[model samples]
Target: MTKELETKGAAIQGADAGKYELSEEQKAHQQERILKQVAKELQLPLTKVKASVSLLDEGNTIPFIARYRKEMTGELDETQLRDIEERLQYLRNLEDRKLEVIRLIDEQGKLTDELRVAIEQAVKLQEVEDLYRPYRQKRKTRASVAKERGLEPLAIWIMTQPRQGSLEQEAAKYMDEDKQVHTSEDAVQGAMDIIAENLADDAKIRAWVRKYTQDQGIIATEAKDSEQESVYEMYYSYQEPVRKLPPHRTLAINRGEREEVLKVRLEVPAERIHDYIAKQIVKGESIVKSTLLLVIEDAYKRLIAPSIEREVRGELTEKAEEHAIRIFAENLRNLLLQAPIKGQVVLGVDPAFRTGCKLAIVDETGKMLYIDVVYPTPPNNKVAEAEAKVKAAIEKYGVQLIVIGNGTASRETEQFIADLIAKLKGRGLRYLIVNEAGASVYSASKLAQEEFPKLDVAERSAISIARRLQDPLAELVKIEPKAIGVGQYQHDVAQKHLDESLKAVVESAVNHVGVDLNTASPSLLSYVSGINGTIAKNIVKYREENGKFKDRKQLQKVPRLGAKTFEQCVGFMRISEGVSPLDNTPIHPESYEVVDRLFRELRLELDQLGSKGLKDKLQHADAEALATKLNVGVPTLRDILDSLQKPGRDPREELPLPIFRTDVLQIEDLTPGMQLQGTVRNVIDFGAFVDIGIKNDGLVHISQLSDTFVKHPMDVVSVGDTVTAWVLNVDLKKGRVGLTMKNPNKKQ
Candidate 1:
């Protein structure tokens, strides 16, 4: 490890010798400062943050450090560890930008000691860019042309407020026809232009003005064509303080601007900015005072105002994007970790209009046993035939649950299924509207092709929908997360940033509920800690060639899965029937000896691991004294005790289950103040869209989320929550249903 770091250090030195003046020692000190700053920012102890950063730098994954290296990191979770890692990368990038900007200025022969210190001390990329703006290269402008015509000295003289001479007379001495200074007035105008540009470029002045604008500016938007109707109708003639704008509104306004439906601009008070600039540049009483005043106004109106407006807008958009990504990540995490509907025979239906509806039946193990196509809606109108086919399939397969995709013609299909269920009342048949957001995307993917080569696209979609109900995490991992449709304005945000954030959420969810090693597909196994796509496929192939793995140690036999991969992923992959019972729990294999010692101290045999007597014994055991005796920390010992209590326990079982319906309702069936049970389909920034066995999903706005104040909709409900709500309003023309969780008429 030392040799590898030394080689890396040499490579950095060889690459950066000419571009930066800082030595290796100085760079190390700067890095140390950054680490301390990150610790302070996160309100974490310096020691834990430092140790976690070191582990990350050593190529250890976040899941590995979080699970296995608790003693070194003070038991920090994956969220905290990932935050430190991201902050570290950001600070390093900031340092690199500083060095590059310094090099650029030095190449221009304009480096000063004060400017160098300021650049090095900057904490944000915006501050560094503000510092570098003065020396940055520019195309030919009014200021540059004036500098070419020998008016820079005149501008500098006016800036000093020399009281001895007339400004126009001094400017006349520099006028020359050959250099395009045609007259005294022209030369004076050129000098003021130069002064205006300089005032515009001042780093300190720009910073002050930026802060003032952001704090005091009003973001105003107006409809470009007032006659045209749009979804952004509320924003047609809107003005709001920049500081008070919500993230969802910001994204909406940005989209409106991008689509050319509205024109948006930052409105700052001009006189205040002009006074601030004049106070900085113009002195008490001089002939050039008036000229300086004119320059300040021109500088602000022409150059600084437009530039600052763009910067402020960009900053707000960046913040809004970050907030949107955070909300999406949280929603995706909750949706992925939803409890699986296990041990049920399910029938999947993919609804369509022109094409026939696709149906697939899967047993308790999620294996497709039968598939067919039926047309029940639209032009074909074969309702009786479709009902007969579905009924036969359900009876033949003993399907108790029907999973219908909420896509085109879904309500019609649901009504037909509801009628069928009513006829076959004694069979205990129920239906659920499954979120099929990414099912089509997954069906068209290369992985889907590899998994179902003989099935068509729609057939694969039906299977995916069924499997999603059986196991959400395993099936959703096969598709990209952004296509899940739980976020607002997902398309407007930066795609790469959104993808990276959602990927981390998926990783956290996957590690939280360990995968079953023998039953997991390669698509699901690839998400395990330290297991990439290639290694996951290799494990599956090895499992196919040899039989089911009877022990966790058998992972070592798979090609490309070395000691490091095994150590990282073994804790997150479970073998239910493995030789050692600990292999099925969340405890790492390295701590098996500690577990053995624990069992020895408890006087329990290996075969008596999950018995009620063993659970009772562990319930009364002294964890603190046992930890001291076993040479392990309390956290590790507590984790071991937890594992022993419930072997192969899934954490998702603690969450609420999906709502199922025996009858279907339509949009016309909804009435104001009607109470109904529903399932949360998607939770966004403003509200949650709920599936209430209706054609149009109901919207529960953030205001109606609770009896008290709700900061966000997710705080009140989550995706897949079984909630009871009252209808607030209904717009039949628009097909929109408004529901509220707070029933005001009912007593508390």
Candidate 2:
């Protein structure tokens, strides 16, 4: 409340009442309300959510709180904590906006008790905005003009309708030639305008109208040019209820509308909405009934309907974008967490027609040992020379795995590699097709240039491809997440939102898998829980200056890495081949004492971790009992025990490795009923695209995903999954292959 309002309210109440104050009470109530609301929304206990929010407020990263403060959060996963964190910020902002709205209204001397209370009680920003809409300043609106012409009294009298006499005469009393109210009819029209504006600005009325439209509205689309054929053909004559419209369809319609290929509109029931507004505003029959009816109709048609339609469309787009972002984030997580084909000397092949096939041989540690170009495809199809060059490079590097970029000329290059493998005797060489969706983007990036300034873009891309196979998380972190291409409709969604979500997914994946402290690049380290790009670079620079990180504790010595940063990051940065075995595990250093005590109780040395003796001893140990003895929470203690069993474990190790083959299959080789094992390249709303040792990845539609009904393709498959699928149809002309996970012989 403003100082003037506070004084006036105090004087109105009593001399002893003093200045009216509710700030402290309001703050406390809002904070408590936010806690309970977040708890109810997330379906977690209030205490656990409160604790998690407090921890979040205290600067704990989501990964750290989830991993170390499990007892406090009741073992809430990173996803839950992140949701709470986001909601916490939202509710806090809501409170701030409410106060600001109150102050703005108070400044105008229009903040009544009921209005202030409504603003304070509003839970969502939309509700607060609705309450503020009436008081918001207008620019020479019809209502404002009516008020200027002194017709507000006439409008108010019509609303009351106490007597049924001479409505025109009453309106004529307000008419003035000087103000452009030349006739009683003009006077009545101005009054009706006032009533229309009032009805339109009524917050409750607008809210109800919006809800009703969204619940019952139908979204209809028609092709701008019916005869034209386009990808949006399916939606050219589409109609779906607003409530039931799926996210993909919403995005498709939006894209079609943006491209001017489809005309779309929300089909609202006009008669029903008009009746609703009449019921809310109109009273008993009177002389002014027809006049008020005109106002209500004009209000609904001219003022409320258009504004509410925009809001409804915005709400739909917001929800659709959210769903799309969720799918993108989930798909990105799976792709980033894919199993790294570790310990392989791999050769990366970037295929092109005119530029030749770029080749780079990377050793097991991802160090580029050789870079060359092989012209294995037209127009300079040097098949034998390309074969000899690859053979020599493979022989010299002892390359066990070859990663071919699935881009232009990939099929011809694959055939060349397959033929070369056949000609070469007993080297046990195998090749895997790697998704090169963002390789060119990465190669042309500044970071890539800095990393490999001496090499051409294609050569650098080849090196990145090989490194991607070796350590997917490490190499993928170097590229922009959206550019990695594991998402659908990425370009259509809001870029800032998509970027934030993808970055969070990468952070979660990196923290979950943990990074090797000594060998991890700044790019990989930047995704660590509490580390930024600057600090990541500082850590790497420190490593280069001092030596390998002797232990995780040495991370503190890096410039700008403070105690909190170390606390949040150390557990996720493993130091294998370090001073202590616990340093190599996911166990935080704060719990090192607990691990030591457990080891002592088990009569085991730290070096004996992962040994048969340690495994046998811990195999039958009760986590609750051990937790009590170690003075730690059961979840953390259990995690400690699990980590002890598999020191230096990479969680990605358990995921399916990439599909490797000695030979490749042409698109023509695929036939119906032919079963082939393939890697799921990308999972989208409609289907999964799988790479089956061919140039074009085949699509496994959601209907053929299972014998049972599948709600989504992701429910049955994820990116990087290896599954056995049978060919459904092969279109050689279109270079398209359709596949199914179901049995080919099974009847539909």
| Model 1 ranges off by over 4 Å | 1-24
Error (Å) of candidate 1 at residue 307 is: 1.1
lDDT of 1 at 85: 90
Report clash pairs, candidate 2.
none
Error of 1 at 17 (Å): 2.7
**TM-scores of the candidates in the order shown:** 0.96, 0.95
On residues 1-748, what C-alpha lDDT tens digit does candidate 1 reach at each position? 1111222222223354565756899988987999999999999999999999999987788988987888899999998998999788777777777777777788788999999999999988778888888898999999999999999998888889877778778878988989989888988999888988888899889999999999999999999998898998998899999989888899999999999999998999999989888788777888778878888889999999999999888888888988899988888998899999999999999999889789999999999999999998888989889989998998898998999998988888888888889999899999888889999999999999998999999999999999889999999999999999888789999888899899989988998899999999998888888999999999999899998998898999999999988988988889999888888999998898998888888889878878999999999989999999999998888888988899989999999888889887878888899999998878888889988877878999999998899988878887778899999999999999999999868797
Cα distance off (Å), candidate 1, residue 405: 0.1
Candidate 1 displacement at residue 106 in angstroms? 2.0
lDDT of 2 by residue, 68-118 (tens): 899998999999998998777777667666766776677688999999889
Instruction: For each candidate in turn, give its C-alpha RMSD to the true structure in angstroms.
Output: 3.5, 4.6
